[model samples]
Target: MIWPPTRPAPDPVRPGEESVWDYPRPPRLEAVRARLRVVLGDAVIAETEAGFRVLETSHPPTYYLPPGDIAAGTLVNPRRGGICEWKGQARLFDVQGGGKAASGAAWTYPDPTPDFRAIAGYVAFYAGPMDACFVGPDRATPQPGTFYGGWITPGIVGPFKGAPGTMGW
Candidate 1:
């Protein structure tokens, strides 16, 4: 599902320049689903073996998922909100049932436009708070600072978005 009348296109990179072509693309959106289960604590979060895309931004790419696949029960409405020009208004969610029950843990767009409708109601976690997060075969680990979730897959190199030296780029 796509959204927003004016979605931001990927930046144009010059040939042989060390451009971070970090934007992700899924072969098939339905092929992936976030499987949620307790890892080391009461928190239940989703992991997908199928493919998903991660975009390049100041923050990490927001992982998109099918709405039916997310475990909605684990989320509680958060008072905070934000806006994305490409998507729409976003609402936050707190991770409940986890050991850290009141954590301002996740976010979603319930009524995004047609472009991003697939991710509507599908939640993405901060990765900092989740006990574990996985993209495909790799386990996601918390990146330094409060910012990123490393979807550590083989052959993928860093420093990913929020890492030290790459901060200003």
Candidate 2:
């Protein structure tokens, strides 16, 4: 198992919360009812309570919002593409709103693995490059570094995977 049972977890996690270190190796997809909101510049680019979260070891939850709930024409122009070992190929997008744009700041998996089929038409934004993303009243902190799009809230703890010396994690 990737989780070291003998390795003392960093923080004391309450009964109902999770520690990223103890998350599963293959990751899990779960429905999220938390009000998810994405902002870029002054515009509320996307907002939805119908979202999904992918939970994996050493990473924070990456929220995926439903397309219908997002603002019209917010995601325009296809950019590059990426491959996730677990989720399959993903198409990137340019998010333009409030007179500003973040190229390839968001992505979607049109055809995903069977395990991730529920999120096929959903979008996940990189909170680091976005103006803000909120889960209910608390604003999220983007997962550390530029490569991963996990959204970090106060509930999650990490020596999160994407930091300077943690790439091998």
Candidate 3:
């Protein structure tokens, strides 16, 4: 693939909406007050009004929930995880709730790079594997592709990366 292939035209941004194309590279981590919720089956595995989101060019925001808000005993087993040049090392987890388990459904940054220190020990779940994830009252759709954990809410728009032939972006 080409290095930094030309990005597709972004969808029009309506009032109070954000276009993923406008986000910065190397990402910007910002604290958010929006209510975020995650569910699996009948269980509400996590919910928080206090969290952070990492925004990057061509990507939807990845919401990170504080560990305290997650259901006890939900995140289990630390599987080997990958390093992000920007965020530092991430440790993966298998999430179990409502008698169901999704392997590698969550991740945390135990000791993040200084810029990301605010989110150390906070967890981010992959919306695709959960029964549902929400940002406020709107349900979130998963960012395309299996590798990214971004939660795409109605307030966000994208011709996001992670689709076929878009890897270089």
**1-169: candidate 1 lDDT, tens digit per residue:** 2233223334454554222244443211233444432232544444444334445533334455544555556677665567766667877877755445546666777887676676676666666676666664456665556544334333443445565444444
> Per-residue lDDT tens digits of candidate 3, residues 1-169?
5667876889999999999999998899999898999999779999999989999999999999999999999999997699999998889999999999999999999999999999999999999999999988989999999999999988799888888887877
Q: Give TM-scores for every candidate, taking all chains together and pairing residue i with residue i.
A: 0.62, 0.91, 0.96
Best-fitting candidate, scored by TM-score:
3
In model 2, where do residues sit more than 4 Å from their true spots? 1-9
Instruction: Summing lDDT over every window of 10 consecutive residues in candidate 3, give the lowest-scoring window.
Output: 1-10
- Candidate 1 stretches with Cα past 4 Å from truth are 1-43, 47-52, 57-61, 147-152, 164-168
TM-score of 2: 0.91
Q: Mind giving the per-residue lDDT tens digits that candidate 2 earns over 10-126?
A: 567877677898889799999999899999888999999899999988889999999998889889997558899999999999898888899889999999999999999899999
Clashes of each: 6, 0, 0
State the local distance difference test value for candidate 3: 0.93
Ranking by TM-score: 3, 2, 1
Instruction: Say which prediction, candidate 1 or candidate 2, comes out ahead on TM-score.
Output: 2
Reference-based lDDT, residue 63, model 1: 59
RMSD of each: 8.3, 3.3, 1.2
Model 3, position 30, has a per-residue lDDT of: 93
